[model samples]
Target: MSLDFVNTYSQLINLSADADPSTFYSTEDYRKLQTLGPSLPTLSYPFPSAEANLVGESTIDVKLKSIRPPFKFTTELKAIPGSLSIYKLKNQLIDEVVSLKEAGICASNLKFMIKSKILTDTTTIGLLGDEVSITVMITQPSHNDTSKLLSDPEPELEAPKSISKGAWDKIESVLSADLGPEAAKIAVSKFKQVSI
Candidate 1:
């Protein structure tokens, strides 16, 4: 027979509401299973070996270069299965990098590039090469995204100034010919008329 436990101890409804929302009980349960802490006592299993599931596919050494804010690091060669997609690789990286996991960086926020060519999530490991350097830019994460804002955006009090105004003033402005006699003057006269 399945055991059905009922709340017997009398507790005020207001007490639960004040502590957290209705989902608090469920969320707290999952918190113990979160792999980030790998949640203590519930140790996470080691990542699968890179050699798994190889048929004709070849493995590659990926050198991750975190180039953007929130986190930046030297290129580190990480091992992975050739069949792993950029999508899966991102999650794998998150699992491996403490800073990335702490920052709550997700796959969508990561922009990957190689030789100036942008890489999509569908991109696979073996397709890159036996060795490759992939640059990453993080969009930033906040509680699974706890990174806080250092400051607010500066408010603009005035419209942006344009530099093209002087060049567009064809009546003897900077764009007009001056020192060289060969080039005709656009305005024909440099003299300024004083207003009375």
Candidate 2:
């Protein structure tokens, strides 16, 4: 039969039409109708819909870059699903890119940001967009984490530490600075929003 591939919607297919056990095998059966061969009858299939979906979720490309640091990395993570959590992306970075552990950065210490906004662990890649480019920053470990690396851990003092009254007064004065007459008003409004 003749291949009516003249239509804009169709092209000559090489693999199985059913798409089961998905694979490609260039056997003599598909030596091409162009070259001398027995022509198979063209079976017209329905036009592919614009939303002809995949069996699973589609993947997005993630581009991560660290502009400055002791640990600098630039890489494109391909075909990653948007549903992937920020935590998983960090692990992927460690696995695929730099030696993060050697740079004193664990997955927990990694920060993913889009411009000024930071991403939480629960944030998914898909929430960003079809493709995401983010800035990666490595944070220094917390005081508790730093203590663990010491050969001898310091013993806790019986009394809690207290700031000097003069220092406290100086800090309060700085907060009450007169950048303008309305500076204190603005600072108070901002401080009200802070949880602590």
Candidate 3:
């Protein structure tokens, strides 16, 4: 089943001309909405290990250092997989972050961009090989005359805003009810990451 209710409720936010979202809304409603949405972050045919198949963590942090025009943005990800080109990941991450920012989900338009390179030494000599991955994140504002458009608080006025905290839980239930266990598990994990 789709997260029709959540989507529907979102559509009716501020009481639009659509269906009665209040009828489907609850303190735990946003969670329910996510439940009706699509499945994300799936593991392929053969199971992919969180280790080997797992690419190192890549994080993009945008810091709004000042409240002026031409603001600064810093994005940095440590322990990223060198095999993956930094430009590709940077571009993709920038796109996604910019989309979220434009959608008004992120805090502010003022942002800072920071980048870091890391190397991990791994050995597979014994019967079993062990891999350890570490991720580090840093935050700082920009240091220049800034003029960036801050995101409007339109999302705050939406019904989804009130239920965002419980959105993932409701979404998990919806997914479990619709998709199989494997898919639900993957979705739940993805949801948790976003929830954080």
Candidate 4:
């Protein structure tokens, strides 16, 4: 059975676009996407065998470590049995991240990292099973930057000088093409009210 891996990966892009960082983190799907295995070691045995072996945990602490603005995390997208070209998938992710950054919809203080790497038959056993995959990471800016980001006023968009019949028609047509017809109609109505 062939699965549409491109569509699956596309959903990730959509998720980023539709949901903010906090909202995304709150979802069950995001919880499942967390890095597997205990990053910190416990005194418990590493194996379930009769002999108990105590392992020393890493002394390095994350809190003590300085995390700069743009904290980053990586996620891997595995290709389906009959998926599109790996390059296409990689490009889609890059484009989506770029779009999100350009739209300023990422978050108040956070920046989306747009780096991606393609892997095939590598040692890295991505979140999914062995398959052609793309590993992408996005950066989460530091909490300290939030206040500054929120303090800044959003730049105002330039309103049209006058919405003539021809201009209105053009606006509606462009909106309809970009968004759906229903959204375009509502937006045009709103724009008209604002211009008045």
Leading candidate by TM-score: 2
TM-score of 1: 0.43
- Give candidate 2 misplaced runs (Cα > 4 Å): 1-54, 142-196
Where's the lowest-lDDT run of ten residues in candidate 4? 57-66
lDDT of 1 by residue, 45-96 (tens): 7765645545545667888887765597755655677888989988877787
Question: What's the count of clashing pairs in each model shown?
Answer: 4, 1, 30, 1
In candidate 3, position 132 carries an lDDT of: 24
lDDT of 2 by residue, 1-196 (tens): 3344333224434322443332335465354334432345556787655456444567999999986677788999999876789999998888887467555567898889998799999998988988799999887655466556686778867753555657545545676775543665566556545623
Ranked by lDDT, top first: 2, 1, 4, 3
Model 3 per-residue lDDT tens digits across residues 1-196: 3597567656656453444668576767555554433334445577657786445534332222222333234344333343444334433344544533443322222222323223222311121112222222222333342333244333445334233647767777789899976798798887677653
Residues 1-196, candidate 4, lDDT per residue (tens digit)?
1256555655655654344556455568676554432233245545554332213211110111112424333334333223233334434344445543553433333322212332332222222333332333334433355667789968989876776898888999999999999999999999989785
lDDT score for residue 69 of model 4: 29
Q: What is the lDDT of residue 123 in candidate 1?
A: 86
Error of 3 at 143 (Å): 29
Model 2 TM-score, all chains together: 0.44
Question: Looking at candidate 3, what is the lDDT of residue 69?
Answer: 32
TM value for model 3: 0.17
